[model samples]
Target chain A: MTTTTTRTSTAGAASTRRTRSSDTPFVTFEQANRRLKWALLAPALGFVGLMIAFPLVFTINLSLTDAFGAVNAGNSYVGLQNFADALTDTRRFWPAVGRTVTFTLGAVVLETVLGLALAMLMRKAFRGMEIVRTILMVPLLATPVAIGILWMLILDPTNGIANHLLGFVGIPPQEFLGSVSQSLPTLMLIDVWQWTPMMTVLLLAGLTTLPEEPEEAARVDGANAWQRFVHIILPMLRTTILTALVLRGVDALKTFDLIYATKGPGGGSDFEAETLNVYAYGLTFDYQEYGLASAVLVLFTLFIVAIVVVLRRRTERSAS
Target chain B: MTHVLRPRAARGIELSRRSFGVLAATSVLAACAGSPRTASPDAPLRVLAINHVWTQAISRYLPELEERIGRRVSLRMLTADQLTSSFNVKLNASATDIDVMTIRPLQDQMMFARNGWIADLTDRVEGDADYRWTDFQDAPRERSITAGAAVSVPVVTERPALYYRKDLLEEFGGAPRTLDDMLDIALETQRRSEGFFGFVGRGQRAGAVTQWSSFLYSFGGDFTVDGRSGIGTPEAVAAYEFYGRLLHDAGPPGATNMSLEQAMPIFAQGKAAMYVDADAIYSNFLDTSISTVTDTVGFAPFPAGQAGSVPHNIPSWSLAVNEFSLLRDDSWEFLRWASSPEMVARLQSEGIPGARQSVWDDPATLASFPADLAEAMRINAANGVGHDRPEVMQVGRARDIVGRPLVSGIVGEDVASVAADADAEFNDFLVRDNRQQEF
Candidate 1:
């Protein structure tokens, strides 16, 4: 009681001093408090500016120049020439864009669907639920490169266990990642395998937080399990699903490690699995076409932003 | 008690804040001072190198180098791609930390040389008579020079050696000397029904180009002819078609996906009859842990085509002083010591081929290699072309362009049309690349 009284009195004395000093063009307590607030916020704002704003601005500027080979080397302003070149590059750029979209859509859609299913299946209390959840988390915890290598081993056309298992079932051996046509789809499946558990975990958390009254009411009204799930649970889970979609969708769109680890530069012999991320990486590091790479990156960033905006708008509309 | 302790807690926070500010200021001052132009007396000479056999072997004997230089030595090894990326990033910023760099002359030397990332070593290499720059093989020596300046010294030389199963080839009268005979043997022995392939090699577009360069040269097809794209030529088309046919018919399923890593294992596991790749990898076949065909493996020169057998004899890895190095003298000394005749001979005797002609000429080095492999290496080295990929500023891009036809052929697409398309694209690339280089 004495300590609180002493601290309060000290604060009041400080406030009185500030107020008295205000007549002499000195800062008042409000002004001082405002300044202190900004002082504390300045570092975080500066950090955000440095980390996010600077690279973005630098990349945009680089996109306008003919920067090649070395980052510190002399380069001339090429205007929109790099952008024009990238836009016209049917060889690598456009195909990469197509693959990126296809992969993201294929992988994210599959992951969301499967994740939601698994989430619901394990939502209620069940035997060995923790063990199953732990097992599911294993793929999510493993490194992408390690997972890629593991999948490569499992999917090896001639020598893999997958083929051996298929043979036991009297089925023909299939080239999973090795075939050009199959490479992208196989990688998508691998992505789905690695990331579905993440979605499941996220959705399961959302599931537990639900009021359960609506579900219970629907159940008492004698609605079918599928009807309740479709009409009630899914509608209630919109925000979580959209949030998970945005997370997994963006990640899938930028997938590089697994593809690079499995197929390597230019994404295989025919550039079969070259997504935009891989294409941009090849341009910057492998080919040293920094200008083109920056242009591609700028375009890629805009593309991602456009997607997030659309998704955000959809989420808002749904919420409203 | 709380009121009494308040001022003390405030004082403690103020002290911590002041200490942090001082530490930050000190760090800023230290950063501003930067690294010294000349390294401190105790500082280790840093060498950035690829994780190769030569690097592995030299690491064991680094103490000798350190003793000679009277300085500590720090060697860091990374994979080929990682090494290139590291150089690109570090050298671009003009980092002085890397005293010596291991580089691929054909792959990135042009870019590095043009960017002024590697120091010009003409005077050091030529002026030192004892060093005997001429003692290096002609092809690798020629490759080491970029833009008319000796920027690097060849250390590890590579040439493709035909790896074959001696047991499989015994009835076919040993390894084929001619391309046609090799194809015939491959086709006949490819028992896909019995789960064995007749031939296995790199088929991935970019990775295949280097190994295919030997085939291209043997077929009288260079990547360029008179500074123009030559892949459209009949010889180039034939080479592509031949390689495609060999892989498509005799190679294992999913051959298009196989690179050195994937294809080598197939041969090592006794699943393939013949494999053509860099001689540097011969040890993989002899290693008991990986190889099922250890006793059955045979080595031969690249098979003859329209032109006689000609393989790529390249300085697959070379030592160059980083242009921004603070310790150029030490770096050159390290390079000199590493590529010295005695050192080269010693390394070669242990089966890592050195660029020194004298070391290759010495029969003592040959004693360590499998007798047949040494013979094949001797032949291939003598009849080798200087480069394995298209010589251009953007080698990776050029390889991708040049390799498109190879993939088409492997997948049973028409070679001529694909070659024509690739040729046109490559020509356009060459023009653009040349324009970029001029800048």
Candidate 2:
């Protein structure tokens, strides 16, 4: 009984103190409070500095030197030569960049549009929403290499079920991944099928946490569902959309396992699926051109960072 | 108000501080825990072998190996590509994960030996009274060892030769003995057959390059003369042009992307009249599970080029021990048992080819194999066509240089331009790779 009474009195006293302090302007405890806040944030700031910042600096430094294979013998300090070579080297580098951009853009756009539609459809309760959601997560969690192999078997021109099914509809057979022109697009479809669920889940979370008053108010002001969603809901979800785009863009740029699993070194006979990440890996492991691969990786990292920064800036502006 | 805020901030700080303090304390304590890979000074030595049918053959004799050496033996199976980079990486980084491994003799030897990744097994071979390098044919032994230095023992001998459908040959004016005859036969047969290709070989850069190199070598077009680019000659161009035409007319629809394994099915399904590939495919074709037309198979030497059937000797697989391996003696004991004449006979009876020379002469072994298959092996072994040399170490670059562009051209995309461009690129690679240093 005594402890309860003391706790109530202490809470009352704190509230009273707060009320009194709000009446005063320019409190003198600001400096101490600011110092304490900074001290609390130091660990996370330091962790990011060490793990992310340090390695990036190290990679940049390594990129400047010519180091091949495990042996550091015959290494020459060739500043900016790696960058120049990466830009001009036609056998493996520039083609890789082109592939990277195509893959990222294709995957991001398709996944976003599909994910948005799915999220909207599943917004309300359904008979087996949980089961459907669980089924969607299977592809996301499954290994990319295993998925590549499964797709390879499914897309085999001779005995695949895909062509068999197409035949039933009186459609001529198509060379899916085997065709030079079709491989990248086929991979994009695969990327969308595997990852759209992740985007859907993220958007759904954003939707649930959304304040209802603004949407309800719009509905009352002679607005249809589409009008309210376009004018209010979409604008409100800009930050979440931006987050999804950035995440997907970064991953799609570094897609290695799927391409490697499907096409061996040099990204198939014609190099139809040779993206930047796969190119760098092939250079390092297959060719033992470590210096060249390291240089390519550094350029690729900068390109990804630039993309992320642009997306983040747009996200921040919209959020504000 | 300041006092109230102070309590909340202090609570936050206390919670963080307590968690961080606990983590720091526990990590410091945990640092003194027991280790994972403590060495047993008195423990019996362990041996690891590279994987394949070769490993399967070696595994059979491990009991004999353990009995002889009085130590434990362990074998691992890794694909050809896995064993290559892993062996190199493990040698550089850990120095322990691998003790013994299999490597392709030519490409792996120079890098491995120059980096001191492999020990000089010359001493071991010389010291062992029973060890006989002379027992093997001189050319293969020369290809396996480096500058008279035996670093590893050869496991399996493979050579690339021509394989054809006997039935198809009978239908298409009989077997081709010359390059012109082969081309003529292919052209004539493809005109008559509805869906069947006259000749199906690798048209993919790396795959086709191996097949192309044999023709080039046979036509007296060397890749390097005293370690310089000799691939720019008329003979080389003729060889490249011949294959390009072959791809254009008589090869399969997707022949430009096909490897030997990929082309095998087409031939096995009776869609392809002929294929030129490694001897390992011999078993694959004979296997009842996969092959459809195994009974109609005919093997022959690679048809005569301008210089007459100079078979291109492609090195298959060999086993090498790591420099820092503790079980050097035990590893050799296993290799000896694995490569013995009796064991070779046993493996040969089961349809596995052996690296030993004595197995080649055995009547029983020859009796078990098809007459054509035996004849092809004997000719390849006799000719020294598919041998590995120091110059072949640049095969990776060569595939891109001589191979990739050739493939792009053969696909009818941009034939001459791609070839010229590849020539320029390969020239630069050759100069940069210090390819001239091989001499």
Candidate 3:
């Protein structure tokens, strides 16, 4: 017992001496470098913190105020009055929210379905496959504002080629963007055209990474092409599909540029094309209702967060 | 860990280093973008102007104006929408990147003055003996004044007038002399003319307000009385209904989307017998490149309303010194010289409507435009009102309030009820803003 205690004390003393030596001027290059790396990261971390925290806090604070117009240039805090007003605002707020949801859902569903079809089409190797892929990406690369203007010219009721083409088929001219009901749907079609290529590329990558054993096994069992796609390929591509939906959905919910370019302020004529993003922008800049805009943005952010959480959970569950 | 490929690891390290460098450079670029490029006071005087034809004409004379003023002026032009939106942003934040800014006195003078964005040029105008402030047309000069202070220096002035086909009017017996006469002529011309409308003017909401105001005034309705909306009055409602009747019954197809930009070309193309629009677009009508009826187009005063022939003879463009600018004096110098009699004559000759009475009166300059057009301008300028649109800081909101009714009226809605609704909305806006309750 005495010998064992002496050995343990001696071992502890040796470790203590080693630890002290390690902390002194004889510190190794790797240890010193590790400490130095954190010092280097400090500024970047601080910058990112400032970038996020400042706006987050500022927006939250502003959301509680009644800051509107030139007279109320963001001073008097009204304590969730703006939020209450927005929550009950059937006229502007609720309508905008409905449009946002419809636009996002319409765009995402179309993009995902179209993207999958496109992915399936491009999965097999063929001559000029590169060219085909490049063609799909053309609209995505074009400036959104330019696209909007181009579409505007194409949809112009008086002189547009859309009406001209319809006239060829003996159909009456349609007010694609001009009509109150047609504007949002027309914008969704544009969005789908622009973003479907992105989803296709993402899904294509996922397809390439997917193991072919299950599909092959199903094919060997005399399963039809439809059966293999539904039972084997689809089950494997769930994560990729969910990822595409989340990506496309997030962007769709925040659509502003195309709407702004096409419709201008207050979302055209009678606010027909106004979604939450456009509504927020008009309030913030056009009318200078900063507080109300901030409230709307905050609510919009929470909504996005809630949606992403659900999507991410589903993605994780399938992955697991 | 078992077999780390040195070359591959080296490539990975190189890639990350390159990425880090790119990130750092991006950060630097972002920082630079956020910072405004400010010039020293002694540097060229920065004049932010709208990208209008008048401003384009002025751009040609900038070098000469700079030499005469003994200071170089750098002119940066933006579209009308950009100027209105961006200037408000910068001015509201008290940024002095811009020294002189273009303004529509009828639209923005009251707003700018209320916000203390523009310097009050009352004392300065009174002090500058050689500036010839008296030479400016009274209507525009009055419009530039806010709370008895000169906040805007008028440059390009315009008034709405009747433009008609000389051949058509001759065939129809004579020019319209009253609202009733004008409407009858319009109906007859529309019925008689093949593949052409009788009248063309702005019909879009917000856009139609100014053109509609001519009709509104003719019917003996003022915009406001004692800070209450005067649009709901019998005269105003009647005027709106009459306006609706003309457009709904005789104007072009898809007239709901037509503004002066679209309507002017329609008239100039001989598709319409008569057009009522700003004097600035007169040059467009004269430009043979686009106008089909340039030779046949004749100018006349607006047909008499109950208030007699009154059209808005207001400055389409004005220059204001930024109150936040350190170079206010330099900006004022540029403005004064730009709007001076000598410059006005040049500008007028160049086909930009000038604010100077002397420029319009000069026989040489007057000859530049048709004699009938010049006469119309002279007569209208003499009887011009102080403001065209609502005299309020919230001009755009007011226009929309007024425009909604105008649009509804044209579409065959109950104009009386629409006018009442518009009045209520306008009143609510004023009450909320704590501004003057009416236009």
Highest-DockQ candidate: 1
lDDT score at residue B334, model 2, on the 0-100 scale: 60
TM-scores for candidates 1 onward, in order:
0.93, 0.83, 0.85
| Cα lDDT for residue A167, candidate 2 | 82
Candidate 1 docking DockQ:
0.35
Tell the DockQ for candidate 3.
Answer: 0.09
Q: Which residue pairs of candidate 3 clash?
A: B218-B305, B218-B306
Stronger candidate by lDDT (2 vs 3): 3
Interface RMS deviation of candidate 3:
13.6
Model 2 TM-score, 2 decimals: 0.83
* lDDT (10s digit) by residue, model 2, range B342-383: 777787776667667787778687776688887887786677
Question: Which of 1 and 3 is ahead in DockQ?
Answer: 1
lDDT of 1 by residue, B1-439 (tens): 0122133333322223345557556755875685767778888899999999999999999999999989999999999989998998888879988999999999999999889899999999999999999999999999999878999999999999999999989999999999999999999999986669989999999889999999999999999998899999999999999999999999987888888888998899899999999999999999999999889999998999989998899999999999988888999999999999999999999999999998998899888999999999999999999999999999989998999999998989999999999999999999988886773
Model 3 chain B poorest 10 in a row by lDDT = B1-10
Off by over 4 Å in 3: A1-39, A46-52, A66-74, A220-223, B1-42, B68-70, B163-170, B174-177, B181-198, B252-254, B258-274, B288-298, B435-439
Compute the lDDT for candidate 3. 0.78
- Winner on TM-score between 1 and 2 is 1
lDDT of 2 by residue, A164-203 (tens): 7988998766667666778889998988888899999988
In terms of TM-score, which candidate is stronger, 2 or 3?
A: 3
